[model samples]
Target: MRPMPHDHSDHPHALLPPDPALRVKALETILTRKGLIDPAALDELIDTYENRIGPKNGARVVARAWADPMFRAALLEDATRVVADLGFYGRQGEHMVVVENTPQQHNMVVCTLCSCYPWPLLGIPPGWYKSDAYRARAVREPRKVLADFGVTLPEGTSVRVWDSTAEVRYLVLPMRPEGTDGLSEDALADLVTRDSMIGTDIPKVPS
Candidate 1:
């Protein structure tokens, strides 16, 4: 008879009482048998969370910052207070840092060691961002990785790569899009995409 595939029974954590045993076991079974999480289902879950409570809430913060120069200064100086000022507080986001992208200096964020991200402000990261390829390559070769993402930096421009660590998180402040001179706060918030928040894309004025 063919030998049964080696079991993972010897794993130390296998038999240990999970904090939430039933849910943990169900997730493990799905991952083990299927070898992948269902992207569509994950997207649905993300959509539900976003609609219920996600960056759209944070978009209002960005809109307010864009409209108010003093608030923008406060946000750049101390993100936690600015976010708190707008009533968008969380355990993780309580110590936030906002990085502004200017004509001369551009900033991109990544987590080299792990997937440390500001979930309270930007919601769940996209699949590409959490992938090993992106995590490794982004820190090792930031400009090249950004180029692949269709974000070409100007010649002689310096690219700063920030690695998000414990106790500190970052959010990118994309430049104000053109033709938004007199737009309402809600309208501006509608244009603030997650990509803009991550420095992968600039917000665009709706046509």
Candidate 2:
């Protein structure tokens, strides 16, 4: 919805030069010279965020929504509270809005200004999500972006793009795959991918 004020000092970019490319070089030069930061440690931290702490938490939320109608209703009505009920809430996720995907309408989330994603639900924002290309094109040509991610919708389905802001981050509750009626919530969560939760892709169907 609206952009919210955020503290940027903790952001790595805030500590470096304005140019994204030069930032790495600058950080290396400065940190190395001062002996304040270790490259290996930094790499490990990034790896942790990118891999280990990913969208598994969000997948669980989606699984719950799919299994329980009341929880789904509450999630759609008041996402912040519903998600917090599951012990997931912090920073960018303080104010959240959950959009459901349907046969008629599909929803996508993007942050035009900056990467304001729900860390509690989705963890650290992906590299592409914060890239300038994705930030600009996701709003300009969402269908094309989706296509790039190998997601093609039917001609009749309408696409809605939700612009995320620092104030309110949005999450897409992707449609549950068919033939999963007998699957438990944990099993269902295994089918939910990070891209699916972000509306860039769809959930995987059991074979």
Q: Return the TM-score for each candidate structure.
A: 0.76, 0.78
For candidate 2, lDDT tens digit of each residue in 1-207? 977677556865675788977987897878888989888888897896777656998999999999999999999999999999888888678898999999999999888898888888999988898989889998889999998999999889989998885599889999999999979999999999998988999999987
lDDT of 1 by residue, 1-207 (tens): 997787666965666456777756677566767867665677777685667556676678788888999989999999988787777667467689999888887778888787877777776677877889888887778888877777887777677778886769888887788889989889999999877777766776779
Candidate No. with top TM-score: 2
RMSD per model, one decimal: 8.6, 6.1
* Candidate 2, pairs of clashing residues: none
Deviation of model 2 at 72, angstroms: 0.4
Once superposed on the true structure, which residue ranges of model 1 sit more than 4 Å away at CA? 1-9, 13-50
TM-score of candidate 1 versus the correct structure, residues matched by position? 0.76
User: All models: lDDT?
Assistant: 0.78, 0.89
Query: Which sections of candidate 2 miss by over 4 Å?
Result: 1-52
* Residue 36 lDDT (model 2): 95
